[model samples]
Target: MSLRQTVAKYFTNHAETRERHDDPALVSHYYKTTKDKAMAKLEEMFSDQQLYDLNAISKEHGEISVYTKKGRKVFIIVTVIMVRPFQTAIDFSVTSESALPFDFGHSNKIIQQLYAQIDQHFTPLDRN
Candidate 1:
């Protein structure tokens, strides 16, 4: 198998967004779904490679200035993990963030945006 597959099989999908805060069922479902997708991606990328070194590359914190109709505060955190590849000699970033909104709607958007950016950045490295 591959390292990515190994990670996917064990990855957690649950997301803790502000929108699902009130509903336990919805929150649980969100978490599982995200976890499953994330794990699948990891398994695809890292299953076979030896863990040469797995370490935190960097963590950046900043605010995204997206002015919506309702002013919502967003706490933007970006995490990067660097891995040493035994097979191809590559490095990549696995980024994630907590999109919590003081209100309700924007959190979902933030999470989706964050995931999309990470996916776009990482998908190519895994393919090669």
Candidate 2:
């Protein structure tokens, strides 16, 4: 990633955890599971009505949209993809609802928190 890209990520209100991200921790995490199971788990997790409120989910497209229950009022979208028979990848896109031009990496932190929760529930695969 370029210097501008790295700098922008910290200042922007939006951050996305994707494949080959500049920060390895922000990269899309691979899990040992089928896409169906991944999606189901995500749905069940968010439906608990704790930190997040489930907005919409598209199992066919492997996408889930949600909002934080409090603090910064973030909008987050999680995407789950099946890369192989039993290997799946999960990604997060987060945006903070704020009037400020920047969020001071709060969005990135939200992604990290989401990843941590996922790690608790899923068997993570080594990134290759």
Best by TM-score: 2
- Candidate 1 yields a Cα-based lDDT of 0.30
TM-score, cand. 1 vs. native: 0.28
Clashing pairs in 2: none
User: lDDT per residue, candidate 1, 1-128, as tens digits?
Assistant: 46763354234322233322342311211111232334344343333334312222121211111112223433332222222232111112122223521233344444555454444534324322
* lDDT tens digits, residue span 1-128, model 2: 78897798778898888788787668889999999999999999899857889999999999999998877889999999999999999999888988898898898888888788888988999998
- Please list the residue runs of candidate 2 whose C-alpha ends up more than 4 Å from where it truly belongs after superposition: 1-6
lDDT of candidate 2 at residue 42, scale 0 to 100: 90
Number of colliding residue pairs in model 2: 0
- The TM-scores, one per candidate, come to 0.28, 0.92
Candidate 1 positional error at 99, Å: 17
- By lDDT, the best candidate is 2
Worst 10 residues of 1 by lDDT: 59-68
Q: How many Å off is the CA of 116 in candidate 1? A: 1.2
lDDT of 2 at 15: 87
